[model samples]
Target: MATESTMTEARPEGKKLRANVKPAPYRIPQAPPMGWSPTGSKRREWVSRGMVGTIMFLQAVLTLRLRNSPSVGEVHTLTDYRSTPFIQGNESIYPTIVDALGITGARFFSLLCMLACTAMVYSWSRRLFNERVGLAAAFAFAVIAPTLVVGALATVDAFGLALLALATWLTIESRQGPAWPVFLAAPVAALAVVVNYSALYYLPVVTLLALLVSVRVVAPVMAAARTAPLVLVTIGMAAFTASVTSNQKMPESEDIGTLAEGTFHWLGLITGLALAGAGFYVKRARMGEVPRGYDEEPPGIGWRIMLGVILCLPPILAPVFLTLTPSVAPLWKPPLAYSALFTATMAGVGLVRIVGRHFRFPQWGIMAAVALLSIGMAQSSYEYTLWPNASRLAEVLATQVQPTGKYLASDPETINYYLKDKTKPTQWTPTSAGDPTKALKKMTFDLVVLERPFLSKADEALEAELRDSGTYRILNTVPFRLGWTRGTHEIWIANDVPVK
Candidate 1:
């Protein structure tokens, strides 16, 4: 060993230096851009985390209140329970869950999913920007009326959105190592599609965004990993859309005025802070302030997305807005859940940066705009929660209609759920089968329920028919509160039931 060392010592000093030195890695990960951390005390990170937790707590409280509200449940809430199964296969035993735990319990499962989405949004926003931005993004998403609505609903939207967000987080995180995360992303996205068909709409947009990020932040996305999911989701979405349209009933006439108002709310429903943040992001991009550890004129991939969105969204959203028609609206009319989520993420980044005086803008101006918009957003959200419920109709039905008796209703959607659980025979006639009045005349129904306050022309005729005919007698007209509005459930009983 000494002889070898002596021989080595005789070697040139330059050669020794070369031997000791290590070569650069074949695939070095990109370094975080300068100013990755926001300009603040280190405590900001902890403060942001705490704030996020508080927002989460507030969301949970709101969801619980909605759940425990006097209303039995939304008409669409329990309808989703059957869809919990996948491809109508044995893989999902979710229907049993509805039977075992009921509406509240199923909705609780969706809550867990919604919370997961919130967590993923935080992680993703934090990774792309900073903790404060993450908190802002999380706040933006949590406060969305639809987000809150889904939290209290036992629907597939929350579950599918959660998985989609998870897949997004995993795909973006691939920048750290470019190995496992990228590989797992496609499978999770696929599962999300399978879980909720709605997810299929936003998959391509998100996948494209992920591709841009993956390539810019760290090049060479795992071979076919990103593109494969997009192609599959596209094909699956088309197939599902065709199947849904083909099997479903023809569209019932809607109040175009109402749909238009709802669409307007969706377009402008984002909180004032989020809108401000999005504007700030655009402002920074225009100023060439490339701060988010990525490349190009618009600062980063996220900024580019915003630019594309601004240019593209108006064309698609305009028809729906201008026409006051649901027929012309695309699936993204309400902003597909994932699309809304990403917009919220950007808004979060924008809000934090805007509030920080990053652009030297007036603080009071920003606060005022945000406060006003936030109020508008809150109002729109409250409006969305005001669908007519069947709590009183349900109560009246229990006492008036016999368990196995024939029943028909003018607006039978919500009442169907109550009758489904309580009644033995499931041969109930609804508005879909044509005029409830004609159905009552053609076939004897033991009970007829007609909703009132603002009835359709046909519904008015039906109510008149029921009243004029001596064969039917009014059992009761129970007044019920629909959020802030008042309505009545007019229950009519046949003169005789099986006169035995």
Candidate 2:
């Protein structure tokens, strides 16, 4: 024994012999324990929930105040229940509801959809980050002027946004348990894509969520199996795009394009391929079978996802501004509210984290900042596209136009809504197409109304045509205010020298 001890331990204190320690056994990553945990203190949770609820309530009350407002006056009408490909599904929804309950019901439905979207935003952020962040996101969404204005209109944007938020929430929930939630997300995503081509941009996000949830809940092989539904989503979107493009009625509708136009351009396709490759890499890397406590450590994959999404807000929100461009734009005009809410929520979260960790600033500072952002954004969005005096404009046009006369107007829908109540029986030509001197050379309109300064190329051309044509005389120039934008609409009568 003494000899053995001397051989094992008699090594000098300064110079130790190498110890034999085998490397840790290779273990596969195990699934996270399935459950839900409420984030943040109980008091804070109640406070956040209360604040979000109050904001939604206030927004609803404000919507009631603007009940007469023709928010979607120019877009949605009985004649053309649907305008853009994005709201194709909404064609059935809007016309049916509006035909039954009138415009008020349509606005109410939109408001309800927006409220649901706001609630989903709160729930998603609350589950992923914390109750405070969720409240901030909800508040931001609720206060955005576009959110309220668009929601109060009879448009599909609010409904599509609601569906997207629901799909996102379900995708996150898929990680907590059954794969059915993930499967359910596929159809929801497909519906959103059909409703608005711009919504196709969300396909990558849904695919990523499915892959993450699958890898965490099932084996790597199972992850691929779960992700198969993503292919179906892609196919569904492609079909919808093709079908919409095929149904163009106009000789040269600006919206005429192939399946991979605008939001689904080559850039989007490449980005989607990269996401698929990343998912495959994630699957291969996690093939080892480990225990279920993979999320016990700090900054787990879930936290990384949340952080990544927060960081991506800039790029994600930037594309929304593209709606201002006419040449190449998304079918459904982007409701800037989504980006505004995302930015405000991210800002709120960052400010709170910084203030709490470094400056010891009051928590109220975060709420204040969020409120200010919400109020300002909402104000900016109010009446941004709405013609407040559209009813008056319709009445004036009706008075000037004879029951049997053909009157050309910029927007038929706006005039149609007012005409619904008016006893006028005038026929209106909604096209703004005409050459400066040649368009009306063969055609004769009893009256023409041109809204200026013209934003549409065709409308500008028609306006110049009417002004330059010697056969027409300007009767009256009616001026109107569309929120911040101001314009004058000219009423022109054909100069008819009596044939007698």
Best by TM-score: 1
Q: What TM-score does each of the candidates earn?
A: 0.73, 0.68
Pairs that collide, model 1: 277-350
Best by lDDT: 1
TM match of model 2 to true structure: 0.68
Q: Per-residue lDDT of 137-194 in model 2, one digit per residue for the tens? A: 5665565565666676765566667777677778767776688877888888888765
Error of 1 at 204 (Å): 0.9
CA lDDT of each candidate? 0.59, 0.57
What 10-residue stretch in candidate 1 is worst by lDDT?
A: 324-333
Model 2 RMSD, rounded to 1 decimal: 12.5
* Superposed Cα deviation of residue 47, candidate 2 (Å): 3.7
Q: lDDT tens digits, residues 398-459, model 1? A: 76556667887765555666666677435566643665666667547888777776356776
Candidate 1 at residue 366, lDDT?
59
